[model samples]
Target: MKKYNCIWVLLCCLACVGTTSCSDKKSSADEQEKGVTTVLPDTKNEVTTQILKKRTFAHELVSNGKVNARSKADLRFETGEVIARIYVKNGDRVHKGQKLAELDKFRLEQKLSQAEDALLKA
Candidate 1:
């Protein structure tokens, strides 16, 4: 009885393997047939082609945004003196130790004289 049971299980396993192999071959054949079928574009559709030519193309961009500088500096005078003249305008490029504006020389001289007098008095 045990031998018969073992034989029965072996037969069932063999049948399953055979069916699986046959299905695999059928699927491969179907794939081959599908691969051989070429899909052509619609003949009714129209396509226009232009000859290649060398030409310069210019691209212009128009945008609106706030631009921030990579580096910024806050300019100020050591003494509270009026500005007499400005040499450069806003958004102008500057270098180190460059004079951007001049102080009122008349007022500065007056202040200097006053300080000298006060020092003498003291």
Candidate 2:
């Protein structure tokens, strides 16, 4: 234990002494360099011209699309009637202009039925 303590004290003394000596040498060098540092500000004060140019680039692409059957139903509406005929339920396959809903046209079909019945009776 006594040996370890002697080594620790020796290291601390050596570190402090080395650092103090280095700082003294650096301070003397800094004093000598101060004369040259003063001239740097005067040299920087003179303006020097530098040229810069702007550049631009444009890019484009070609595309094509089909032009056919341009008809469209912006707003589709049903008459003020109940859904009498629904050939398809929810989640059913559909194509263009497929019959999806029918109003309460029972009376209209019945009228045709009556006309056919009269023709049979005759």
Candidate 3:
């Protein structure tokens, strides 16, 4: 019984080795016939080339919403001053140095007077 078991184990090992060698040989022969060479890919320094061909892609953007500006800005005053008046409304075209809103100067004038009195005392 031990002799039969050893024979079966040897046959299984031989069968696996034989199949692996035969497959390797056949694959190498097939690659040679197709002029294919095995090359290790350099994933770190891989260079890819692409042809710049013009492709027309038609995409219909169907919606009830309007396409607004690509960029939007929320303008505000740097100081925490009260806004007395606003010259421009929403979606208004404004230029640089344009007055957008007026600051409430009554409180600002009182603060300035206090600061000046402190400076005079010092």
Model 2 C-alpha lDDT per residue in residues 4-117, reported as the tens digit of each score: 999999999999999987775777788888767543444546688989767675668878996564454443445455667768764455697888777788766887899999
Candidate 3 to truth, TM: 0.43
lDDT of 1: 0.89
lDDT: which candidate is best? 1
Compute the lDDT of residue 4 as modeled in candidate 2. Answer: 100
Backbone clash numbers for all candidates listed: 0, 0, 0
For 1-122, candidate 3 gives per-residue lDDT tens digits of 99999999999999999997777467667777798668997678769999988899898997797768767887777789889999998778889999988999999899999999999999
TM-score, predicted candidate 1 vs. hidden true structure: 0.42
Superposed model 1: Cα runs more than 4 Å off: 1-53, 111-122
Worst 10 residues of 3 by lDDT: 20-29
Cα RMSDs, all models: 8.9, 16.0, 18.6
How do the residues 1-122 of candidate 1 rate in per-residue lDDT, one tens digit apiece? 99999999999999999997777467778888987967897778679999999898888999999988788778899988889999998888888888899988998888889999999999
Instruction: Give the higher-TM-score candidate: 1 or 2.
Output: 1
Cα lDDT, all candidates: 0.89, 0.74, 0.87
TM-score of 2: 0.25
Ten-residue stretch with the least lDDT total in model 1 = 20-29
Cα lDDT, model 1, residue 35: 79
